[model samples]
Target: MGAGVDYIFIGDDFTGASDTLATLARAGRRVRLFLDPPDAAAIAEEGLDAVGLATEFRALPAEAIAVQMDVLAPLLKALSPRIVHYKVCSTFDSSPETGSIGAAVAVLERHLDPALVAVMGGQPSLERYCAFGNLFASGPDGQIHRIDRHPVMRNHPITPMAEADLRIHLARQGLQDLLLLAWPEIEERRATLKTHVDELMRAGKKRMLFDACDQGHLETIGAALGGCGSDGRPLLIVGASSVAEALSGDLRPPGVAAPAQGSRTEGLCLVLAGSRSQVTAAQVKAARRFKPMPIQPRHLADKTAAGAFAASCAAALAAGENVLAHLAPTEDYRCSGAELSCKLANLVAAILDRQTVCALGVAGGDTSSIIVRRLGFRSLAFEEQLDAGVAICVAASDMPQRDGMRLMLKGGQVGSDAVFDRFVSAMNTKSPTTPSGLWRHHP
Candidate 1:
């Protein structure tokens, strides 16, 4: 294989990967996301400028993350992209035990070396910002809180953020001495940004963290990144989908972008919610269109009950009713979260066996990763934007029944309450010819 692709991204989870797919495609670049790490030959056939690999690294232990990376690095090296991006959640969700960014980076470096390992600190589109190297995110109530103080992320079940200072947080995961290019320097020395990083590198810092609040900052950062490495090798990057947002401006043609809508889907859609977040709970409550199927401990623990649950969902879909399968609110179950998620995933697979939906919507970051991986999808292409942080994608698979399936994978904290309604409407209507309001820029 040759250095033919413009960018290669490895997402820590499916939600972020799908968001990046929307980013690149909306920017007018041809991009596809593979559920598994794909080969150069398979990618070349798609005629894409960008290729992505989605993984469940965000929900795995450090040892398991390292093991997955070790298996992936060799194949990634063969892709020979101009930039290798490690895409993380805009919230920077990870911990020393699970989803350790440092551990994954260490394993990757053992196989491929780059001049710099740059970390972009904020994705304003997601209301995640960093100033002076301390990360911040927004609450559903629309308040800006330091990540460690954020209402939901502060108490996230998988990786609760304890420190706002990214350096300290990542250092705890083994990435030490990261040089920060704060907003002041990024603003004051916008023209000499790359030179600033060079000086920082000369001062013994090998890794870099950049602060950005808007598109201008991302473009400036993208320029600095694009200008790196005279050796003609790809720059290795880390951050949210803004990594694509930064680079995409150059690839997009004037006035051309990803469509905001596709001709609305014309049949019943299926939605699965595995996130226990209050935000998702609100969306589920506000929904009036779907036949909600609430999961219980008995439904998963007892095979007969599980079959009844799956059959109920399939019957609803077959009867021309939209379906929303989720956990009941304010209830506790005697099982690990992972076990519950796995059973939910099995139900999705089983339902697909009996019923076919015009489109599928999935909520929750970790759940999206687990279910998409379980479904044996080969690749995903941007179908349309459901909302900020949520994208409707078309899934391609080896199975005829699954190929060309329309999918929307959403992060738990993302989108508006009417997001589900919008998916229902978007699927049954025509997509917009112009791209606008695909995302919101937090000021």
Candidate 2:
């Protein structure tokens, strides 16, 4: 088949890919989305042509990976887009399947020109809770480096590389106005980040971006360094679960409850707690305790309910109605099997229908990882931050039938205070009606 489009979004889940497409569409780019079979209608409703791929679900990681590759091969061959955008998980290294990256890369190599494939690796863990730096860079050699110091990075385990080494790497890549993303897990590392940012500025780096997933940090950083991106561009920071904390000014210490009657908006809050059953339970309990209103909980295990909810939410959002979506797996805690796969396909399909979801949230590590993968991303990974905190994603819908959604990956054990705060804040700052639909949700 002849090449039919200019861009291909691979690896992201229904919600994320749709949101990204919404963002791109807002920028006036004509894009075609390829998602799993179940999400085709959501894509079609959004006025974008979407193709679905068939594959096996819930097999061993290796086997499942094979199925993914086999299904995507034909679509890649047929579309032949100039740009193949892979929305990869940042925490792939932590997954059971060791060769996911290699396998995914191999599949892409066969279908698209390697040079044209740009991997947008989103850090799901760092996006949920407060982290020290905005963004960090890791080279192919496995060395880690950062662009600025973030308080949360202090005393963390993730290693930090020398600023000089990072600079050398970037210079070698001939990357100008480049953004670096990293999870700085120690005090020394945070210091190193500050130094790096200063050095990069001194070196005349035009644009520097970081991932600040928490709200308080965003404001603090915003105050400390006014004007986001260099040269008048908003510095891009991926704010995750802590987005609510930043927005609602509720970055209180864990266990400290905010007043019972606080002003908060109604929207979906996705609490992404990896497979820890206890963590998921706590989030449900916490939501009941702190929410401004009685937030109804919907168990998504029922495929029909899950799918219908997803579709209704998408359609509502497309019609310019504010929506709050909180997607958590069932109490059974089953993922990565044939049954789970089918359920996920339905959920994703629902989300894809309405690209611009007003406020979206996801919890659970495995759930986060799987969702990220479904979005057509290739290199990003999700790490555990704060034991378990909710990651928050926020996006706006400007035009009818298009969607822009943001993501915040929160740890399960993290307090509900931070999660709720960030969600409210994101809703408050949503962009009003604009010409193009933009999917500016940070995952």
Candidate 3:
């Protein structure tokens, strides 16, 4: 906290946070992500090059996001990193009512008082691109589509992406007046790009968006960003893990850097899917190794019903069968996503209370955040990359039973059809000793 750390990122959810963690750690940078804000002593003790605070704000109302940021502002200020990165989902999933990225930007800008607000608009490594202020992503069907029209995102149960233009989308959330530097501008000479940025800054631009058509664009954008605030003021950046990818640029040469797989253990592997995304539904269906046990929506509202369901999952695990507890895809929930996620977390907690889970997998960002918090994990170290946007993590937890438990978290839209099957196999693959994954801490 004495200013050695160059960057501090506040991730909107656990999955995105770990993606950023992977980007930095794989870059050979010493990084650690905490479940909550750690004290300066902890920061100093970790000898971190970058620190992160993983949050569940992406599932909250705008007012709630503001409240959370108010609590975090002081801790962020204490770290005093050269850059304060506010990491949002790569797909830029949000709405005016919930997970408002614009609202978050406004709050952080006022509190952190950075020289400028720069939003990195693409994560090309994941094949996500931003051109002319529109966001596009590769779909499971092997075609790129505007995020609003993408098969999974268009019909997202919550925060359905109705618009592909980020400027239009964010304006609805009160973040208008953002200046844009298109892909062509990004591809121009570095000095020319700087001149454009300077002109905008001189004209009183506080927030600016840059287009990154590919990984090269992200690096060029990152190289330009790396030179930001050399005048000694901290730069406030916003985006997904690509922000880290951009910042680490040429400093750390890129490589495959696959995450380390944990040594297999002997207990049952449990999977919980609280997401209703088509991607998740397919993963659940294809995960043949696990006995599927779908929870009805009505049962989520009734504790007795939920308990009975948990009992069944516990029974299956005890019989040496890996169980998949998921919300019925066709069932309509009478509760909010947050509420239903809480119910799912409660069920998972109950299962942990009754069974010995050697490995666990949780799908859905909000669900993973709530379940991990309920399980009392204070920190997570990247263990392996189960899929794009999914990281198998080693839990550094306060709960003795859960300490060092191998867990995997996947965003609803992330992973493939066979993702769940692969997760189970990864957990089942035995190794002689704990793999030399990235180092992590609980305190």
List pairs with backbone clashes in candidate 1: 26-258, 261-431, 262-431, 264-427, 264-428, 264-429, 265-427, 265-428
lDDT per residue for candidate 3 within 166-278, as digits (tens), equals: 88888898878778889887887555666667677878997888888888787777777776766656788889888988887542233233334445565678999988877
State the lDDT of candidate 2 residue by residue for 52-116, as single tens digits: 22122212364466567667767655644333444332322212242243355445555443421
Top candidate when judged by lDDT against the true structure: 1
TM-score, cand. 3: 0.91
- Flag clash pairs in model 3: none
Give the CA lDDT, 0 to 100, for residue 163 in model 3.
Answer: 91
Candidate 2 Cα errors over 4 Å, as ranges: 1-3, 12-34, 37-60, 94-99, 113-360, 368-417, 421-443
TM-score of 1: 0.92
Better of 2 and 3 by lDDT: 3
Note the Cα lDDT for every prediction shown.
0.81, 0.36, 0.79
Q: What is the lDDT of residue 148 in candidate 2?
A: 29
Please identify model 3 stretches exceeding 4 Å from their true place: 1-4, 190-203, 250-266, 430-443
